[model samples]
Target: MTLMLCSVAAAASAHAGELPRLRTEDGRHALLVDGKPYLMLGAQVHNSSNYPSVLPQVWPVMQALSANTIEIPVAWEQFEPTEGRFDYSWVDTLLAQARKNDMRVVLLWFGSWKNGDSTYTPEWVKSDTKRFPRLQKRDGRPTTTLSPLGEATLAADRKAFVALMRHLREVDREHTVIMVQVENEIGSHGVARDYSPAAERLFAQQVPEDIRRASGKQSGTWAEVFGKEADQAFAAWTYARFVQEVAVAGKAEKNLPLYTNAAVFDATGTAMAAQVASGGPNWNVLPIWKTAAPALDLIGPDLYLPLEKTYLGLLDRYARPDNALFVPETSNAIWAVRFFWAALGRGAIGWAPFGMDATSYSNYPLGARKLDPATIEAFAAPYRLFRPIARDWAAIASKHPTWGTAKNSAGEDSTSMGSWKISVTYGRNNFDIPWPGMEPPPWAKEPVGGGVVAQLGPNEFLVAGQYSRFQFMPVDPAVNGQIMSAEEGTFIDGRWQASRRWNGDQISYGFNFNEQPALLRVKLSTY
Candidate 1:
């Protein structure tokens, strides 16, 4: 009996060590699954769609989008309704159904904070405000946001998170759960930092040495260290430390790749921290979050800004040498789908549109007003094109040079890959200039156009996009560049299967990508 137990224990340890993780090389990152690079064609369900009864509404949507990963919530209230008592029935059901559907899971832990509020906490935690204190406003009145400074609250949340991780280790030996989100949009909205007596005491004291060094400031109080941004900086430090404790404890249990999503602040440099979610992992406070939460694999942005510059700018901020870009949530509007190319171009590890389930709840102004067929197709088109080649793309992107673009505010975009300059124009016909008396395409004025181009070799490229014309030219005008061959195909089990070849009219003007799922492997040559 002793020998058998030892063997079982060794196997479990091996499995735990092989859990999903993030790998970064040459400033690009990949989510390593089953010891190989994996791309997340992900769809995040609505907040309340984790119940067994509601799960039936989710799988069909996952099938519709051709998503390989399901990002769903596991509410702390539902997981531990009674204090110190745990219930993982819903988690088990979710894992079982995901396996049946052949989908991986990214469990969003809606604990302590959900969208800048503590509403997801159990009745026990919510009712007893004294034990688990709430954040105080400037006037000393308590707000709905919990105080990260509260030791009791931290201890409770840490204990619950650890329990969840422990249970995952026991039941998830097959590694169905690829990643875990620590919390949802954690931060303080309306007010910058907790103004409670305890919070104020810490605020007046010298800033922690680690944070001071990370921020490149001399030893001083929060106000002295951060100056005008003191309040927001303090809040970020407090929240980051709180999340760090929880993540550390949880990792000790299962060692899965854990991350936290930020309710992104304004990218225009106009809105202040208090105006947005102050303590969240905003672009400005990313250094603080990184310094405080070293255990977290990454801090992902919950992108909702759909504009050209602002959206792309946030991608630049998060997809850094130190951080991997993962859009854990974005608007599911048709117009927002093009940003997927932008993210892919930046070598994002994962991207998911929020509220993707058929739960009949619409976030409206934040996302699509409805989950109609057209809305579904808008997202489904891009997923269909990449689903078969996701793993291939993930591996190539991690090791190769790639570029992605979306229709700009001016209805065109361009980038340079190696010696070739690639430009794209949306809403055009097969010809670069329309023939006399020809009408413009129906989608000419529509808000759509984007594609991703990856350099496979010195003069070879893999290209894919929709509703745009991709033209490649040699950077040096002295050399004449031409498309030697363009093969339309998809990657099957890591091999490219060419369905047809494009020539004559197709290559005459440029590679015109209509509203179809098409991928191209193009080889270029100089005349």
Candidate 2:
């Protein structure tokens, strides 16, 4: 993956010549923007924070967080307030703000579905249920969820999305908007699948041929084909098909990468998967979505589960040979940084924390809504540390093996990747300089330190971590190796700018990585 920078004046030229594309190398994925490999150190604004007035706060918070890109909504109701008369003012403002701030934008389309509810639909559509009906529960009662079976709703959403793409082409000649999320957490909340008359008729009929072929099943009805999982599978196919139509229409206007994010359901039964948000592309139903929605460039997970296993498990599941890994939304908790590194190690194209501003709006996940200074720093630390070297890292991270780990107080931790074994130790005193009778500092007790290591060559490595100790050794004991040189430096525009040489006591025991983040170029020799 190469990094290509589009000049400010003729940004349209880059898109015209070669638009942003997702490529896979050695079963890993990379997103190339303007022809260059790009890493998105991103943050997502609150659902209602994309308004003109609220965006003032959003930009400052993005700057404070040191984010290179932001995810903001372009609501259907806001864009098409009336029936046909469209307003591009909000989108125009968002693009302008992003350009002024020198940041990229991922526009989320809150059309038809926003967190399992059609509340964001235009008032005109919501008022007339007959024209644009809502999903029905098993009892035949209308729920807030939009009915994907409704042609009116699908047509309205497709028209609005296509308009957005067309307008984006006109104004975003610089290609400031890199990607578009088709819808927000699409699915039914109270029910597994819509029980509307149209939905029932289709469900009772033979299961779709494409879905059966994709799942490798013989001809059968929905219930007979999927048995106990019939309802969820039925809903997934309908929802995916609906999103594909909207995405196809938009891509026709401006062919940018398009994806939809799922409100993740636990594969383990520790949490109820049905209650989480059914009908969307949950892990189990991912194949159905893939076969049904071929137009979708990718399917991402909005990981809000706070558990370590769950977060890492989502990364493992989504980073498949066919699908690229991208976390479009997650909480703003300090622990999120650890998952960021984990995602990188797993070859994720990008990851962003949801509701990253200092303010809160509505009842969107508390961890994401209200941001504290510590939380901002927790996320910003990596972004600021990686900004200069991000392009180079993105180019090489997927090709070469990489590994990451958080500070584990339980005991010593280590990760072996490529040709080196990296041993990580917690709560270490200042060993960079000799201090007789010195004790470990207070910050060492519960220090927040984790990092990512990417092998650049057989004997050369790139290392960055904070608040821990890193010792590099040969993975194979038979390969006698010693550290040849360790230069603490920074990458300025893909060039190495070394400032300090580590010898004598500095790297005698191991690198005493502290709160201050630093990038290191280490070389080793096998004797």
Candidate 3:
């Protein structure tokens, strides 16, 4: 705080080894400085209101995590509240501070959308709906939507957004802000995807071939690609329409990496996501987003679902040759490895938990409205594990096209985690106990313990569960070829540090009943 923060013409990290020079190459995403694979261990502090002031205070926490990139939001309300008014001073403050801190920024436009709510609308247009417009529901009611039919909303959104892109272009072409999310959660709550008569008219019509050409399909209507899978009849048109309109505006500005976020829908049926929308995007309608927003590089997931099954489904949805998977928002704390592993195994470019900035987050559990404390504690473990491996993973993914496709280099399933493993089938196997616990349930068969596992480097990993004493064995020569150990610590004052060690053939940390998870920085030493 006392010293003048140095700035990178393109990007800079305050301290040596504080952050890495990051870039994505080919069709893969990785963080590299001169040219070595790096994984991006990042956190998104969705703090828009407290920009310049909070940035200096907030960045030290990120730098302590050894975080490579910082994902911050530049709200539309602040940037452009009026038709021609554009204020980028906050962005200037943000970038300059980030450069000083030696951190990179991934800007989120809290414009036309943010959790599907237009809460960021500026004072001028927000007060006047007649000139701006709102989307109508089936009952001819105004559904808290920025009218998809409103040209003023579109113009306001585009102008501010274009200004943002232009600013980032001139200031960030060095790619300091390596990528940008066009809008926060596009359809997390826009129910029925705008039933406005104008929206309806566009929805009923066949999708233009230009969209099809953009998406990569040679032929077929919206329903044809996704099928009336979920009223495929109207959704394809609506979702495509929404994506196309936004994408055109963004690409029309700058081609810097662009993406949109979607909330996950129920996998059981094609029914609209009950908590949010009827016509909003689910897994089935991605092709339309791809086609309609060709210039838009990816349609990311804003995951809140706790179930691992749904995460696998979501990963399959966004993981594509052309589309790299990145989660803009996900559950704060939970056994999120199922999702993280899925993203890495399937070649996701980037991922982060939303609202990570506030310490109050620890007390809130999930989002402002949702509380799932166990889920939060479960996920907080991985945040530390990623610090050392962040750049390495990204570099590997970028260098290795097969990076995302290879679920396991050594054959581990992507979905397994420690806490769930103990509850799942641990008491059933005959394998001897490494940690404490006599197994569970009278119906329990043998002695087997299952926990969560993540491979950071060749042999290095972080593994934990309902507390375990793992007796590891080598099945292959590679497994036996290296000396292994891990650093055990939690995020204390923003840095990942080791409190103790679990030495010898097998090491263990954490108690069996606390519900708290232990993370290890597994070091696989070749020398």
What Cα-based lDDT does every candidate model obtain? Answer: 0.88, 0.81, 0.55
For residues 5-111, could you state the per-residue lDDT of candidate 3 as single tens digits? Answer: 11221222433332223344565554344234444455678555346766654665565545566788888778876668899898888788777877766778787
lDDT of 2 by residue, 141-165 (tens): 9988779999989999999999999
Better of 2 and 3 by lDDT: 2
Off by over 4 Å in 3: 1-38, 47-50, 188-190, 209-254, 278-280, 337-339, 359-389, 399-527
Q: How many backbone clashes does candidate 2 have?
A: 4
lDDT of 2 at 169: 81
| Weakest lDDT window of 10 consecutive positions for candidate 1 | 1-10
Q: Total clashing residue pairs per candidate?
A: 0, 4, 34
Best by lDDT: 1
Candidate rank order under lDDT: 1, 2, 3
What are the per-residue Cα lDDT tens digits for candidate 1 across 1-527?
22432343345435543778899888989897776677898999999898999988999999999899999999999999999999999999999999999999999999999988999999999999999999999999999988998899999999999999999999998889999999889888889899999999999999988888888889998988888888888988999999999999999999989999988746757256655788888888888999999999998988887677878888888999999889989999988888899899999988999899888899988899999989989999999988877777888889888889888868788888888999988878877664679988888888787899988887999899988889999988999998889999987656678999999988898999988848999999988
TM-score between candidate 3 and the true structure? 0.69
